[model samples]
Target: MLVKGQCTICGPELENGLPSTSRFRRLAQDNTLVDGPSLTGYYTSCPAMDREGTTVFWRDGQLLAVDADLASHELFAMDDGQNVMGRTLLLGDGRVVVSLDSEVLAFHSSLSPLAEGPWPCGDANLRGNPVMS
Candidate 1:
């Protein structure tokens, strides 16, 4: 539930701090988000399904790790340790959904079965849904 002018965790702060011109930095400057940790896990652009897609990562709500950055805590990019599963579904008209299910953390979206929806399978929703497997 990211809304303008609200202080949410927009994403991980870069290891070296964001550039002055970065949109996320501007958002922080505008008081849209609080300065937060560089949560463990690398950042990746969401699938191009909507106008306001996000950079995705995995963070369980209970893991309040403030000292260690996400980059130092996981080996996801090397594929040497835990494997991560993530998916994104597009519901059309700027509705993009992201799911990270390694161990099922705090999921915020509602999911319909593949067989049931106002969005039909094989339609724009299916084709445009970007999945990060």
Candidate 2:
């Protein structure tokens, strides 16, 4: 079940619920959280990045993602990341080291995400009709 153009180096597959080896092992042996207190509503105030308000929402098992600052809603997953020239870098990458402006935080793979997914604007352009104007 391989797809074309999937990132080999980045290795993000959460958009599809698939994960690399370590992730698979964690799921198999680790505690599976269910029932009891659930995520009825959760909020976190990430480092602010000017201009306007910033907030994003996503569910544990849900696939769709929504960010408040965006003009229109996007289905891509992730939150509180920067938009580079054109590409987006998820804040939870093991490869990337996060810094807090004046203070530089520790650099370690311990911050790595359990799973990765397609890039921010990751979905392929598959919508619509063939009308040449």
Candidate 3:
């Protein structure tokens, strides 16, 4: 599974049902990481994945798209100086929906939609799932 931290995104190799520290793939990193609030008005971090498995996340006020194998690229930059405070939505129509500190915006994504599934957009219950429990 993919994991997102304050300064790095990684996919860890599971060994005996546990993540192996030395075998994790470091997908991306941002030294100037910025914290963002969540829908509940608390600072949290989460990333969304499209149907095509391309991961999308916010870092340093920029929207990034990363593939499964460590290929990452910046998709968009938020110039309004607002933090993305919620989980991104990968709609069925190829649109990316994000909630910022002041407003909600939708951008056309080149990636495919999340369509329909138990874990569409990697959010099983339509919540960000910030806490593992």
Candidate 4:
């Protein structure tokens, strides 16, 4: 989930009996801190997950893709000088769509195409229902 307030906290947790939680920090290509405990409201974009459990989100002008464990990850910098906000859409063909400050952009996501049924984009669906496909 996309966490706001003092910092941008994004991670995953096991939902079963023994629940475990982990928080990750956003780093630049040079491995420098981009957003974490030192920053406030740095996570400006929404998150989307594919059927295979790969997750995608944005932070500090960069797109982040991570596995379900929130371990292995990749980052893509947006050089268009715009920040992404609102919801992110995962297309049926493995494309991630988001709206920038002044335009719309689509990125080829590492995630697979969405499932056949209704898929969760971010926090909820268009009807504000918390159902997962």
Residue lDDT tens for model 3, 1-133: 3433333344322333222222324544543322222111122225566645566655456666766555666677755566447766666666776677768778887976552333433345453322211
TM-score of each: 0.24, 0.18, 0.55, 0.55
- Residue lDDT tens for model 4, 1-133: 5332223234332132322222345433464643332211244455665665565656557666665444546456745556446566667776777767767778875578543333343335653112233
Q: After superposition, how far is residue 79 of candidate 1 from its true place, in Å?
A: 8.5
- Higher-TM-score candidate of 2 and 3: 3
How would you encode candidate 2's per-residue C-alpha lDDT over 1-133 as one tens digit per residue? 1111232111112233223211100111234421211221122112111112111222331112222222322233344332221111223342222222233232222222312222221233122111111
After the best TM-score superposition of candidate 1, give how far the Cα of residue 17 lies from its true spot, in angstroms. Answer: 12
What tens-digit string does per-residue lDDT give for candidate 1 at 1-133? 1211222223334343333222222235455644433344433322221222232233322222121121222212333233343444434332334444443333332222222222122344453233322
lDDT of each: 0.31, 0.22, 0.50, 0.51
Candidate 1, run of 10 with poorest lDDT:
61-70
Of the two candidates 2 and 4, the one with more favorable lDDT, higher being better, is: 4
RMSD of 4: 11.5
Screening candidate 2 with a backbone cut-off below 3 angstroms (N, C-alpha, C), the clashing residue pairs are 13-116
Point out the worst 10-residue segment of candidate 3 by lDDT. 35-44
RMSD of each: 11.2, 16.5, 11.4, 11.5
